[model samples]
Target: MSRTKKDDKPAGWRKAEIIEAAAQCFMERGYHATTVDDVATRLNATKGRIYHHYATKTDLFFDVHRTGMDRLFSAIRPVHDRGGPARERLVAMLLAHARAMLEHHTYETVVAQGVQVHRFDQTTEGQRQTMRDLIATRDTLEQLFKSTLEDAIAEGTLAARDVSIAVKVLLGGLQWSIFWYRPQPGETEADRVALAEKMVAPLVAGLRAAD
Candidate 1:
């Protein structure tokens, strides 16, 4: 969090520096192509600096994935836990998710890549275990939707033949935006929220029970 723009990381925030720099390196060069050295170069620190925190590239990858999961859970969990009719809470969760995905683009993109990384057998066992942990956390994230969807159904506010399918479609719609959503220059946070609301309309509307 140094004021000087040359990547001068303060002492207390060194691990954060490693994570952020590693995220950028992974985003640009990919996991296989990026090394600890690459991340150190970006942070303007020695390779030893990154090593002091993360033992290996795989460790750094998991930390990036953990950060992304943290963003998602931190954003939506509060909205999910609040007392409300399920539909309202679900809408709030969707709005929160949309905002997080659009605003935290780089970190979230790394989260999105975990499925592919899991499929690749070349990574170390530790990396695969990290992915399993991430996948489990992601499943819990989906459970938020399933819980609300059940409430909405019980109240006759929404209907679905299969709630699991509904959950997948609803959350999958949000994930798709990470691929194509880019902020237009000079756009504000309000602009992004409005856009997220618009993007989520189809799925939210489709869940409504007929009049």
Candidate 2:
């Protein structure tokens, strides 16, 4: 049966529900092992609703990946835009990034893993285009980090060095924290923010140009 827009609920709501359900499945079973039916069942919906929004499992998976990455980048986009001293903005960006990751740990995990296995080459032309767009969005987010780092370097708030390498080290350190941070009985977001600040402080200090 052909699925049409009329068959689905509001486009925004349907897409959000499917992405949420798919993220849950992808996180639990990994992307390669997850199926469209898995997401449908998780949401207590049917394949028709899934098809109305996504042409294939690959397409839906791409949506899940994109949504997760967007959430992380959106968390810091405002901080990046709010004009301020590079050092203060950098600190805010790092803390925001860290909080987003810790709060959406499962989604972040799936996104990190999806980057390795979700190849656009495996899909049809249309699907490949969608994947390319998502990849572009991811790259755009990374550029924000790069720009902030460069600004800090130019302002002498960060030490003189390769900005690209510095951005990588910063992201790698922040992302890897997801694997080690466990919420104890009293651990809070503030605790995570403190840890993130501690991690960034030394890197920022070390990067500052000698007076």
Off by over 4 Å in 1: 1-12, 123-125, 207-211
Candidate 2 runs further than 4 Å off: 1-9, 119-121, 181-211
List model 1 lDDT by residue over 76-122, tens digit each. 99999896899888888988988889888788888877777777748
Cα deviation of 120, candidate 1, in Å: 0.5
Highest lDDT: give the candidate number.
1
| Every model: Cα RMSD to truth | 3.3, 4.8
Error of 2 at 52 (Å): 2.0
**Could you give candidate 2's per-residue lDDT for residues 1-211 as a string of tens digits?**
2356544557788788788889889888887888898999998888998998888887787778888888988898999999799878887898888788877777887787666665433768787677678788878888898898888889997777787777878777888865776556787878777776776666556655761
- Given candidate 2, what's the lDDT at residue 76? 88
Global fold similarity of model 2 (TM-score) = 0.82
What TM-score against the true fold does each predicted structure earn? 0.88, 0.82
